[model samples]
Target: MTDVIVGAALVRAGKLLAQQRAWPERHAGQWELPGGRVEPGESEEDALARECREELDVAVSVGGRVGADVPLGPAKVLRIYAAGLVSPGDEPRAVEHSAVRWLGLDDLDDLDWLPADRVLLPAVRTLLAGSFSSLSTAQDGL
Candidate 1:
């Protein structure tokens, strides 16, 4: 069976969170979503939440799947999901990455994303657009 790696498209306000890889000379400095492998017997959502806590020191509420499965070599595949902070006021820290940034729609394209993550931009774009609209609606109600 193929191993599944889950990525969190963690969004807040009108931005999406991205992390920069810190190690492995080949992938260093490249950006990607915060996530890790889904362990045996753990549901994808549970794994994602756990990963966020481990990698970002934040609690996330996993939502629906965001994009298609991206094949990673022969035995692994990447799946992304929409997620949000359990406490909207909470900030995420980069525990495992070199750095973390919240990228707006305009900022997404410029980052040097990891190969698997680059392909998911369209779906992430759609997700962020929706987030922007929701933020606008909420602000307008104020």
Candidate 2:
């Protein structure tokens, strides 16, 4: 059976959470959405939530599925899902990542996203607008 990997796109107030890789030197410093492979008997949404809790130390509400599946390897496919924090004040602490940042629309394309994840940027942009709104909203305190 094929292995399914889930990626989380958590947006808040015009910003999307992005995580930088820390290990396997080759992919280190490059950004990828926070998630991991789903284990046997685990649902995809559950896997995503578990991944966030393990990697970021936060709880997230998994929303709609995002863009097309991204090829991670011969056996893995990376699929992203839209998410929001269960609590606004619960900031994600990057326990497994080198760093974490909240990225706005203008800042999306500039980051060196992992090859598998870059394909989802367009969908991510759309998701961000719905959940976080615009730059003006961020300024107006929405």
Candidate 3:
């Protein structure tokens, strides 16, 4: 099975970073979270970091796993994770994305996402819920 690494970067008060692919890229012109396949010999975390850097020119701080291993189509195992920007100023340079936006979780439904991500949405939602558990806990403290 094809092993793919996907990142969910949270930024700016809960907005999640999303990207529109550039032409010639897989799922070109569609919006999805930024990440790519794990290169041979690279760990998933390292591959994620490399993919983000190569595709967006922005550095990211890898975070906890928000998604479970998922099968996409007939031969793909997608590993999605929750991540954050290394710094708030690290806007995407979009090397492979034609456009990039920081989206709120509620807004994710509006985008035309890549097929793998589309199939992975239920898990993404559950993952985001897990990620937000901390926020809810903090808010309860407030």
lDDT to native, each model: 0.96, 0.90, 0.74
Q: Distance from true position, residue 118, model 1, in Å?
A: 0.4
TM-scores of the candidates are 0.97, 0.90, 0.79
Expressed as tens digits, the lDDT of each residue in 50-90 for candidate 2 is 99999999999999899988887788788999888999899
Best candidate, lDDT: 1
Question: Per-residue lDDT for 39-109 in model 1, tens only?
Answer: 99999999999999999999999999998999998999999999999999999999989999999999999
- Candidate 3 ranges beyond 4 A from true positions: 9-12, 126-142
**lDDT score at residue 92, model 1, on the 0-100 scale:** 96
Quote model 2's TM-score.
Answer: 0.90
Worst ten-residue run, lDDT, model 2?
Answer: 130-139
Q: Is candidate 1 or candidate 3 better by lDDT?
A: 1
Residue 4's lDDT in candidate 3: 66
How accurate locally is residue 20 in candidate 1, as Cα lDDT from 0 to 100? 98
lDDT of 3: 0.74
Q: Write the per-residue lDDT of candidate 3 for residues 1-142, one digit (tens) a residue.
A: 4756556544544567788977666567788778888888888888888888888887787877765676765666777777777886767777877888876679889998877677667766665665577667888898
The order of the candidates by TM-score, greatest first, is 1, 2, 3
Error of 1 at 104 (Å): 0.2
